[model samples]
Target: MAEPELALDPIFLLGAGRCGSTFQQVRLCETGNVWIWGEHSGVLAGLFRWGGEAANNRQLTKYVYPREPVSSAEEIETLQHDGRGMAWMNGFRRPDLMAAQRALVLELFAKRLPPGKTRWGFKEIRYGPADRVPLNLLRMFPAGRIVHTVRAPFASIESAIVAWELPTVVALVEQNDQAALDALYLKHLDRWNGITGYLLDLQERWPRKVRTSRIEHYEDERRELFAFLSLEAPTGSAGARIFSKADTAGGYPGIARAFAERRERFEARVAANAGRAGYG
Candidate 1:
């Protein structure tokens, strides 16, 4: 086994959660020409959060917050246990954290990349506009590619609702009340709007570095996607389909019909922003 040749333009698969990106990740990994780690968004995200490159409500005392003296052992213990002491102990700086994160990311990929393979990357679901991973990745690999995977809005929302343990679209129909179903539809519609808005912002900001693909037309766009990734087309056992519509939300007739009924509400948004991604 020889050293895997890293790509000048590593790839990042981006999309809303439950949008069929796992299938794409598996298929692309099957090519054997690219080393792709699936669902390790947290690795980059942790570094981002530590570095103040991204923000979340989860942390009560951020490193960027005013430094408070903790002379007492009890105060020190409390701060450490409360998640604010590590940054304080480190002088509220993140250079060491940033270095450790980069080294860890590289080591993880090195362990995973097959010998003689180049062009390694990862697939992560949406991390919002403030995420530092995208820019951090670019700094690490200036020409890195960002591929946004899209799905039909209704199907995506339906899939997301179920996966996120929210009420399913099917349940709305089964409840058999028009107002209830309509309200469910509206809720999902709002969720999808946020998703598409984020994607559109990324696409616009990184027009040259970013591209979109639709899950619906993945079969047709398979070759182009591989070519874009600088991978050879996969065949034989590796190329066999690993994902099936029968296993996903779209397979259910009732759910499909429910989505269709509300198609008009989301169709215009999709057509306007997702057309390039192959969603109509």
Candidate 2:
């Protein structure tokens, strides 16, 4: 009596936090065929650790039902040897078990999306170097398309400081301590560098399935981007709402000067990432 369900072709948007992914998510969802949930990588992470009784056990109901399922910590630990536990224990190596897990997860996504949507996915900012979360997603949904968003390091760092009101940047602004400023800048730079490296690696490893997009050119290239993902491209101002408000603030002129003062030092550290992000 019920209609058959549409198969979800996942479209994952990956990047560091504050790299314009939220905006991309809005645009992609505007296509009307893509149903997306925001930042649920914790669910996938639990699946990764599900079968490993050797590791700390997390209750599946905590992730699956998420409606205050009753179980003490010790009671939850006992589940590692039960049905859901066994589903992932040797499941990763067994084709049938892996398929079951994938089906279950896909069914979970289907419940969240409204009818008539042909595809589903989510945006995750949690993955970086050495993190197995993204890898696990790829394993679960091999048919998924991965879009990595990138932004200029200077803009990302400045926006982060302004948006979060980071203490490091605040201290550097008020106190002109050269050593402290350099240290804080390097910390942000290293993080951006690591994220860029991970994106490069994903692109190389999955050339056909993975693609990089610069936030700067995203508006101009929306047509091609939609084509690559097999979605109807947005036109006019239908999907052009800019979600990130960090750059609208006026303090960047002062931050730019601070960066210029240490340009030589910062440039050397981020040269590769800048090039990869198309920020020459």
Clashes of 2: 0
Q: List the lowest-lDDT window of 10 residues for candidate 1.
A: 53-62
lDDT of model 1 at position 209: 71
TM, every model: 0.66, 0.74
Give lDDT for model 1.
0.64
The candidate that wins on lDDT is 2
For model 2, the local distance difference test gives 0.69
| RMSD (Å) per prediction | 7.6, 8.4
Residues 1-280, candidate 1: write the lDDT tens digits.
Answer: 9855545667788776666787778777666667778786456666666665423323434554345545566666567765645554534233444566666767766456676567778888755555646666655566778788877766676666555533555666677666776677677666566656676676788777776777777777777877776667665433445334433455566766666776765577556655555554
What residue runs in model 1 are displaced by over 4 Å at the alpha carbon? 1-9, 41-43, 53-98, 115-118, 130-132, 162-171, 177-188, 219-223, 234-254, 276-280
